[model samples]
Target: MRWPRHVASLLLTAVLLVGPPILLVRLVGWPSIDSPQVALWQWVRDPLTEQNLILLLVGLAWLLWAFVAYFVTAATATRVWAGVRWLRRLPLPTPWQATATGMAGAAALTIATPTAPTPDASHPGTTTTTGTDHDIVEQADTADGVALSGGWLPYEVAEQVTAAAGLVWLRRRRAYRPTRPHRHSQDAQDLAPLPSTVAAIQAATGSRPPPPVSAPAAGLPPIGFPPTGVGLTGPGALDAARGLLITALLATLRQNTVELVITRRAVDILLGPAAPHLRPGAGLRIVDTAAHATALPADARPSLSHGAEGGRRVLILDEPPRSSLANSGATMVVLTAWPHATTWYVEAGGHTRTSDTANAGPRVCVLDTVATTDLLTVTGHLQPPAPDTPTQPQPQPQVRVPRPTAPHHDTIRPDKRVLVRVLGEPALLVDGAALTVRRTAARQALVFLAVHPDGVDSHLMAEALWPGLPGQRLTGRLYTTLSELRTAARTAGLPIIDRTGDRYRLHPDHVDVDLWYFHRAVDRAAAILADPSTAWQAVVDAYAGDLAAGHAWAWLDPHRESTRRHVLYAYAALAAAAPDPRQALAYLQDGIRVDPYNADLHHRAASILTSLGEHIAAADLTDRYTRRLATAGLTAEGALIRGGT
Candidate 1:
């Protein structure tokens, strides 16, 4: 709703709250209240004698306003609250319920990457740490990266997801380089993510800042857990403990900073059935007792690997019996909250209270065991069975860009033609070379025109391209940018941008855009009678990358994702219409290259390979899917299956 409407609603609410009492007071002060029937009857017989016609109309109008106000506030509040996450923090789900919820999150929620390399987070090393070694309690924002507790707000979640997803893409560029100690010290700014990734996050969630969801449960930052000892008890306590352990493991997985001291039984009982697949990645130690899991300086502990950093170890406990502390002063984690021993009490809902309910703190992101599994799976800790795989030991599918017979945007003739390419990096091709416009805004204006084929008014163009600028400045900026674009086109010896009256547009006769061609191909493919292979191939070939990739313009995200959907449709249709199983697998494999986390493509490819009697190859395809996820730290949202899924 607009501000004007909100203002009107506010006024209506005020009148609604105050109006009834005033009306009652006015009735009580009626002149004929103390008189007999004759006086009251006389006034009633000629109501105009007591009050003017205008006053009667005014009173009627007030009644109508009150009626309208009641519906307005009630409807808007309900609509607004429906999207808010605060009230949605669902009471912890049961094992069955949690499994369903957690699996759904695995499919929907994107797993975020940490800010920097931890011991085993990215490249395998030892216990986790982001920067300098600081005690968990000492750092206020320890959970800001992994947010084992989900984001407190919707946008916070978006920021975390987008940032991490961006990093995932960026790391691909550096994947070929060997992991060395010095790589950690390289500048972080060189690898910062673009804004388009943030918009992609919005596209994925259907909201740039999707509504905050009430998480099933969460615990405080594992680092910040009370060192003396803390316990989880009451309803959903075990689930909370499971989530807590998962959070701690994930957080410290980078640096080998945390050691788990528990018995064989505790693993299954605490972490659900997903616990068995846990591979002890670098720095993780699961021992039976504290004495064995004790933390010592690398210098003091000769058993430590040569040159390994020391003294930041954290002990995680879940009542593993059979040993004593023996003067071990390291941080202790106890499963059950206690009065004298447990020190801190945590409920399933993530409300933290000391044993006697005296000390309390705000809740953190929490999850049920099912969700915990889903999260760990996304981070590559737990491996779920391949939903549609025949078996998982076959040849790896090559990640290749399929070459098409039809011309792509890259090879098109630029002889006296202006080509705007928004499918990859925003570029203007003149004579087959890029035209570097003087101003960033100038480049943006060209892209803006490319996306909007029909001419736009200066006001719309100004507001979209430079939203918060004052009218005078917006107008000047728009005029300057347009002039610069025109000059660049002219210098390149082509007439490109055209201005008609108060509107601006690209010249239809001289200009062509890849986006325009993509839409045309998609439209042709949509025709019911069309033999679509040629059109489908055109659609696949046309998509070079995301719309205005590397740029973060808020308006570009929907277009990028929309284009992705179109390409996926083309891939599916093309593969379906292929003559043989091998051809279909090839088509599906190409699609997988573009989007490695697409479950449909992987499933389809696996099924095809299986049908062709290449069971090992099919198994390899499924195995590749899991490894790809582990490489980029993504979990494909596969087909929903619940048979010990």
Candidate 2:
């Protein structure tokens, strides 16, 4: 229940501000007044006396202090209660806010109480004084005034009252000072302007001006603006230019294309669906370090190294090389993402050179994507070069030798196949070595296929993998995941999964799946029911644990439970066919261990124990089973065993 705001404010005022002064006055043996109102009236009527005058001043001061304290406390209480209501909706404990408020109140009380002074050797008699000199002076002055006025209250008492009141007032003011909230202007200037194509090129290449365009000759049409096609505005213009530049560079490099050294991540990004198609036949070399690039075979084709190169050959760096290309005997050094707009670095005469103009040399071309595209388009229209004259063949001496018969080789040894285990924790073993398949979707696909040997169609696979995704998105993700799985399989020297139409499957001959073996053992045991001991034991041994025990997929639960039921059946068959009672009891116990809640297995074990003359043990087992069933909110299916079975 909550009280009215005025009532709560009045209560708080009486307890905190008015009560403290009243208690202090009482402590000094001041006349005990039952009613605060009567005390105030008595003080007003008898103001001539110093005692009454002091009381009247203290009461009026307290009334003023209470009024201010009441409003401040009421405002703070409203805010705190609102916060409490908000906190209650969260997951926090119920009493936390109250506990926090209590702690804060205690802290305020501690700060309000002045620390008593420690004894000093110079002044041995004044050990109980407060530490502050102002407090001591105030107390001394109050005591002297009370004595001079011949007041009813003792000097020490008056001094104590004044000190307590001053401390309380100071503490209250310090704890609650109202201030206006700060406001922010909506028109604040931005610290930095947005980046633009011109700004980016200038920053990269330095403050050089753009190359001047040559005027067209007389009777020739001026190079009017190339068709302003779609995706040629704003930042997209830079992207389109970059794309064309890359295409031109690749085309030029194809003339003598040798080795292409790039980072794996960069290769993936550049070769993604959105990037331009790269011409085939370039020696695609991926390296994780610059050191690897330096050690590449020199006999390989002309190289475009992402960083520095060691050989004295034409090196096209995608970005500026860390070391200067000067005196390196490089035929050409093309730097992309140049630091300046008008200037670029080049290599010529076995030294690195800087050019501020576009017509510096045939070996240098520092142009953006659009410029590169325009140059390539113009060059493509030129006529073919004249054919070179062929040289006449010269005669040379030759020796005749007998040719030796060579042995013919036909079949090659196959690579070690992949073995996937999903009976327990999912694992992929290639050639007896564990292969870490990091992608979660790829792993899930493998596990799903392992359980369903006769592959699942793409539609069903999609539903299982991404349950709530849209159809188009689901199809795309499924294809990407399947591609990743096939790549991983091939890289590990395992047979790639084959897809017949929309159905994807791993060949049984190449992939030995553990789930298949478990099901095979169970099938064999069912076929040989006459003497099923060996077959059933094989079934038990093949099942290491539940299917995909560690992976959490909703679809996996059904497969896990199905596999578990098969194991339970095998255990039950072995127990019923055992010749000895003890052996049968052991089999039943094993079945119970696999599934503790199987009341049938528990009953069989108990019956075996009773047959062996262990009546007490059998009864205890039955009691335990009964308790388990009750705990699971299940009624016992059979009568509970007493002393005898």
Compare the candidates by lDDT and give the number of the best one: 1
Question: Scored by CA lDDT, what does every candidate get?
Answer: 0.54, 0.47
> How accurate locally is residue 442 in candidate 1, as Cα lDDT from 0 to 100?
78
Regions of model 2 farther than 4 Å from truth: 1-416, 626-644
- Model 1, span 233-347: residue lDDT tens: 6554565456555545554433344443443445666665556655554334566554455534433433233543432344556653233442244445555544445545555
Runs in model 1 with CA error above 4 Å?
A: 1-161, 164-416, 455-480, 492-495, 499-503, 528-530, 549-553, 631-633, 638-645
- Give me the displacement of residue 537 in model 2, in angstroms: 1.2
Models 1 onward score TM values of 0.40, 0.35
Q: Which candidate is the best by TM-score?
A: 1
CA shift at 263, candidate 1, in angstroms? Answer: 33
Q: Residues 1-645, candidate 2: write the lDDT tens digits.
A: 456987986787567766766776776544456798986777678758887766666667667766777787898899999999998877753598889988999899888555863332221112242223210111121111111111111122223223322222222222221111111111111111111221122121111212222332232111111111011122222332333233233333333232334443333333332122222233334555433444455555544333234222223333333444331332222224334222333331111123443443111112333322222221221121223313211111121111111111111113426778888888877777777776677888888877666776999887665542346667877787777777777756656576789987776556767777676566556667478788888978888887887654534534565566667777887888899889988887887777666656777788888878999888888788678655543445544333254
RMSD of 2: 39.0
lDDT of 1: 0.54
Shift in Å, residue 154, candidate 2: 70
